[model samples]
Target: MNWNQALFPQAGPLRVVQGEARREEPSFFPPTHLELQLQGAPDAYGIETTVSIYPLAALLQKYPEQTEGSVGQQVKALRSLLENPAPLNTAAAFRLPAIDTVNASLAVAGARKSLSSANLRGVRYLGAFSQDVRRFASTDVRYVFQGISRDGRYLVTVNGSFSGNVLPTRESLEGSGYDVAPQPQDNDKDRARYEGEVNTYFAGVNSTLDQSNSNPEVTRLDQFVELLQLR
Candidate 1:
């Protein structure tokens, strides 16, 4: 289906690094959620970042206080709660400041509750220049995500470049008025490689989700085996 091509028609060549899917079981993690990690691919925009997806239901369960308002309101409330030190446990391995970084990234994307049932539920994106380009000038690239799927079970994120001195703070990367240029190093070979990789990842996700009673732990193992067999 050329998901990337369909999603980001204007985007240049993409490289897939590490694609992993894991189910979060209830234990000490607080809320149970599905986590999908799409890593690698330094886009033509000179942006390098990983895409992470989390279910909104789990997030609300973890922070019941933030669940009272609309999706946008919830996001805002959670942002405020995560930023403060009082809500975070000092003894816990998870640091408030680190979580604040993630929350800050989500804020940069301006994820909010959806007003319409057909619309996206929430999103949050943030990025900075690579270490090599940090000193001279900033290229102003940002990664973004959209909450597709009705249940808010699937959140898709990607890396791309945007215009203006300020980084992208929009809900959707598409139609965000970003100027994307093709990479000088990209060729037909790279394009084909990216398409296959993307397809494989999505196929695995669909297959895993189709099962009525899917064991996330076992599914992860099976996925790893399938990936190994493919190679």
Candidate 2:
């Protein structure tokens, strides 16, 4: 079941990032990954991953017509969402096709990161938008759930972070004063920055999913799925 409409009533963006932001405010883990690395030696033995709900604009861009069985060719498929000013896709509405595409993408992407929902134990969808940019005042709402692995093991963890932005698009982000245009960099500074921001947001959502403060936030910038696991 989809949680977008059910959890987000006041504003799409707020509802999207609320839960995730709360988790990330202190850098996801209570003590932060750096502390964990120094204290628990997690780097010696621990895996982390993160998962987030696609923004409405991203959904529209990637799955405009609900095409299936293929990756790429979707709307806004990796475009700079933070700086773009594209209109939100609230009118297009989230559909099964889009959801399917997202799930498929998740499955493939998750596998690449050594994670999958088949091992999902539970999930809490967190909204992300402009409102909770700081998350000083808000409530965390739980949305969506899938049974854990029959072996009594939570194969994967999922945090449902949403970008409360009505429909995140390139035009929308650019209007918001974010540097989202594509560029070339051998050092990949722009790519590094983008990954950092995305990871930061994703950590927020994952931290919430591990509400009790059990799982550790990821250390490596690339291992987002470290906050997410799939059996």
Candidate 3:
């Protein structure tokens, strides 16, 4: 998939190292070979490769104090769905696509795990939007799943939404005081400061996907999921 289009659709500008100095410019990184391959996978799975849910700000305001708790419950429920895929296969609302994509990746990676509906959890919705959005009136929810290979040699954690657009967009970042605009010339000192700001911006993104520590395994699963997504 086009990571830039999916994750940074509204991204303004980014800082990059151009020669010895840094330059702030609107950058466009072509989709890598791997990304292209994954994107070309069959669509029989019935899952939306790029999921654009509602905004996080609306969800927080709607859930308020119960956000974390609500998300935890949603995760647990999704795990149960993974353990049982029968409902997913028959239920149209589940959107539980076939595991061919995941399984194929595992095979290429020499993982013995066979991703199937039985072992894979259905993506669950964690939060919802308070207001409607034109014809698309859906809530912003988090999706996650964990599975172990048949031989247990590899554990698979899938933080659903392959695009990594789980958090707010650049517009939201700008509203939060982030320098979404590019810097024309970045010195060493300016780079350091900008890097820190960038880190802080990501921290906010992390917080949006952060779940409670009640389940340590889930946390580890999330970490692994992130690793796979990065790859």
Candidate 4:
């Protein structure tokens, strides 16, 4: 796979690491992968940008979204979610990949939500997530585009971490419309209510990520993926 470097983060030097990709937990089998990083940012900034591509079988759980099925069925199901998303769909949340290992639960690792396609490959899910949702520790909030190849053999993800875009937090939720209570609610009912606000926040984040430098308003990452070719 050859990617366009110009589509990557332009702020600093882009670090390229190409080789096998691992899962959250070590596996006897290793999958081929490529990772692109933007250096010179603080820990809070996280990976300014990352692109991960790997074979579907590399994961301990082969299903794209941890669903039980054959590879074709799983790919169909994952693609269906992006194609026929529910109201304010967050399906992309289930598809985040573990950068280091193939056996991680990407769905629950961080707080994430997504809107419909941002358009690249067959599907480009415009997604948002926190590096550490429970702690709200990092200033970095990621906007990602995840998809599979037309032939259904690969899973590719492009992610960018931007600062100061934390979604609603327990403390911040004090007066965050969904929970105007003097103190944020701690019960399951509050969680149900807050779900709407969380999705709404991701929608806004998607809009911001949709824009990019230079003319025509297309994100460089999107532009880069536009030219992505895998053999």
TM-score list, all predictions: 0.30, 0.22, 0.27, 0.51
When summed lDDT is taken over every stretch of 10 residues in candidate 2, the lowest stretch is: 29-38
lDDT for each candidate structure: 0.31, 0.27, 0.30, 0.46
The number of clashing residue pairs in each candidate reads 3, 50, 3, 7
- Candidate 2 C-alpha lDDT tens digits along 13-43: 2122232222322122111111011111123
Instruction: State how far residue 16 of model 4 sits from its true place (Å).
Output: 10
lDDT tens digits, residue span 1-231, model 1: 022333223433333434333234211232333332333334444444333344555544554452223233445543443344243222111111122122222111211111112323323222232222111112443333333344445433333332223233333344443323222247888777656654453333223222311234223322222221100
Name the weakest run of 10 consecutive residues (lDDT summed) in model 3: 103-112
Q: Which one wins on lDDT? A: 4
By TM-score, the better pick of 1 and 3 is: 1
Per-residue C-alpha lDDT of model 3 across residues 126-164, encoded as one tens digit per residue: 221112111111112223343433332222333322222
- Residue-wise C-alpha lDDT for candidate 4, range 1-231, written one tens digit per residue: 665655554433323444444345334233555555533343643555666666655543533444443343445555665555552234444443333323323322232233222333433433333332222322324445556665666677666554443344434544444322233378887776666555564455444444422223224445666677665
Of candidate 1, the 10-residue stretch with the lowest lDDT total is 107-116
Model 3's TM-score against the true structure = 0.27
Clashing pairs in 4: 22-100, 22-101, 22-102, 23-101, 23-102, 24-101, 24-102
Candidate 3 overall lDDT versus native: 0.30
Pick by TM-score: 2 or 4, better one: 4
Better of 1 and 2 by TM-score: 1
